[model samples]
Target: MVLVDAAFIIELLLKYSFPVLRDENDRIFNKPLMLQDVWSHLQLLENQLSFFILEDLFVPEKIPVSSYGEDAEKLSIISLSLELFTSLMHIEGIEENLKTITSTFC
Candidate 1:
């Protein structure tokens, strides 16, 4: 399983580039669970990414939804991705956090 960053996934959606999606050598697993946010973001973006996901990677079982934060609310890919990017842009030790997450998953 190949874990992908939510931000990268959104980039793929916005850019309409799915080179990673097309990789048949490994099964794709979007981590730090955020499916709803991804759907919501795509919805706002004129259904571009939604269309791609539906046509390309629509495996219900593979799309895992994990809990987050105090409420243990389920995160979507869009929110997660935006949060990740926003935090990284503002935080001082973001490089370290980025390295840790990327090394652990990607």
Candidate 2:
């Protein structure tokens, strides 16, 4: 159920982020647009990371946090997710993505 919720959230947001591209002839196109180079890869990774954070955040309350020494698996996973999020947020473009995400949610 948790996994389903996470997947749903990620997919929904991805649908909302329809990227468009323009050609030298001033023609605009979507999805089928060709993307290459390190910069493009970085942008793609940043978006994916942002989406992962968004997915996890949508149901933070669903992550069970048990007492000390009493079934901590879920809690640990949640912590790890947040840790990764914070670490990735330090990346250049990711901050913008996070800010956009935060603004949208709040």
**Candidate with maximal TM-score:** 1
Highest lDDT scorer: 1
Report the C-alpha lDDT of model 1 over 1-106, residue by residue, as the tens digit. 1123334564444222223334443223243335445545645644344434433443323432222133223133433344544543454545567557656764
lDDT of 1 at 32: 37
Q: Tens-digit lDDT track for model 2 on 14-54?
A: 22221221334422123343222222443464334444555
Please give each candidate's TM-score.
0.24, 0.22
Give per-residue lDDT, candidate 2, residue 70. 42
RMSD of 1: 13.9
Give candidate 1 misplaced runs (Cα > 4 Å).
1-74, 91-106
